[model samples]
Target: MVTYNTMIHGFCKKGDLYTARRVLDRMKDSKDCLPSTVTYTTLIDGYCKKGELEEAMKCMSEMNKQGCLPGLFTYNALIRGSFNKGDIKNAQKVFDEMTCKRDIITYNTMIHGFCNNGDNYAQKVFDEMTCKRDIITYNTMIHGFCKNGDNYAQKVFDEMTCNRNMITYNTMIHGLVKKGDLDTARRFGLNEG
Candidate 1:
């Protein structure tokens, strides 16, 4: 199973999805070793990265048909793939259909996707997060708000009392500069320095 997975990973890494699928088919034929969650995830991620969302969805369906429950990573890959393809509807559908408990990565992915697409739902996802958010979560929101040319970035920045990494400061400063608030940007840079 390890060997087969490695071969699949190699093929997928090389963008040889055709060979990757063939390897997966061969692995499925083996009685002792079946495709695991990792195997399907690798293939799905590869397809997603290649912008081959249809193939990724097909692989997801095959994984479900094989009785292998999709894990968090699997769902994340699908959501990201859908979003990357600018298929927000499908991305939301995948997110809504997720059965497993969502982790930070899932929420973060959605937030990033929504923000990148200039969608206002980034805040909705941020507000819906019940789990503890890390720096990435806050950073994503701040950056999104700034990108959208809203004052929400300042609101979010003011809310963060700690865990403010360089990214947080830089993003805030950049946003301020972009908004023609050079004074605020200079103050932030000085404080960071």
Candidate 2:
């Protein structure tokens, strides 16, 4: 199984999905080893990174048919793939399907996706997240709001009294500078320094 997975990973890494699929088929036919969730997830991630979403979805279906339930990484890959393809509808569908199983990564992915597309749904996802927000989650929201020219970035920044990383400081400063508030940016920078 490890050998088969390594072969699949190698082919997928090379973007030779044809060979990857062939390896998967060979794994399916192997009597001693079967494809695991990791195997399917790797192939699915490869397809997603290549923007071959149809093939990724097919791999997902095959994973399910094989009685291997998709895990958090699997769902995250699908959501990111949909977002990368600018298929917001499909991204939302996948997100909605995750329902009760969403972690901070899922919410962060959705936030980043919506923000990258200049969509306002980032806030909705941010507000809807029930899980504990990591620094990545906060940074993503701050960056998104800043990108959208929304004041919510400052609000989020101010809320992070304890967990502010360099990224948080830089993003807030950059946003202020971009908004033509150089005085505020300078002051914020000086205070942080």
- Cα-based lDDT for every prediction: 0.92, 0.89
Query: Model 1 over residues 1-193: C-alpha lDDT tens digits?
Result: 8898899989989999999999999888976799999999999999998999999999999999999999999999999999999999889999999999999899999999999999999899999997888899999999999888899998888787457899999999989999999998999999842
| Candidate number with greatest lDDT | 1
lDDT of 2: 0.89
What TM-score would candidate 1 get against the native? 0.92
What candidate 2 gets wrong by more than 4 Å, as runs, is none
Worst 10 residues of 1 by lDDT: 154-163
Candidate 2 lDDT tens digits, 1-193: 8888899999999999999999888888975688999999999999999999989999999999999888889999999999999999988988888634898889899999999999999989988888888898889888988887899898887776357888988988999989998988998898652
In candidate 1, stretches whose alpha carbon ends up further than 4 angstroms from where it belongs are none
Local lDDT at 113 for model 1: 96
For candidate 1, give the lDDT.
0.92
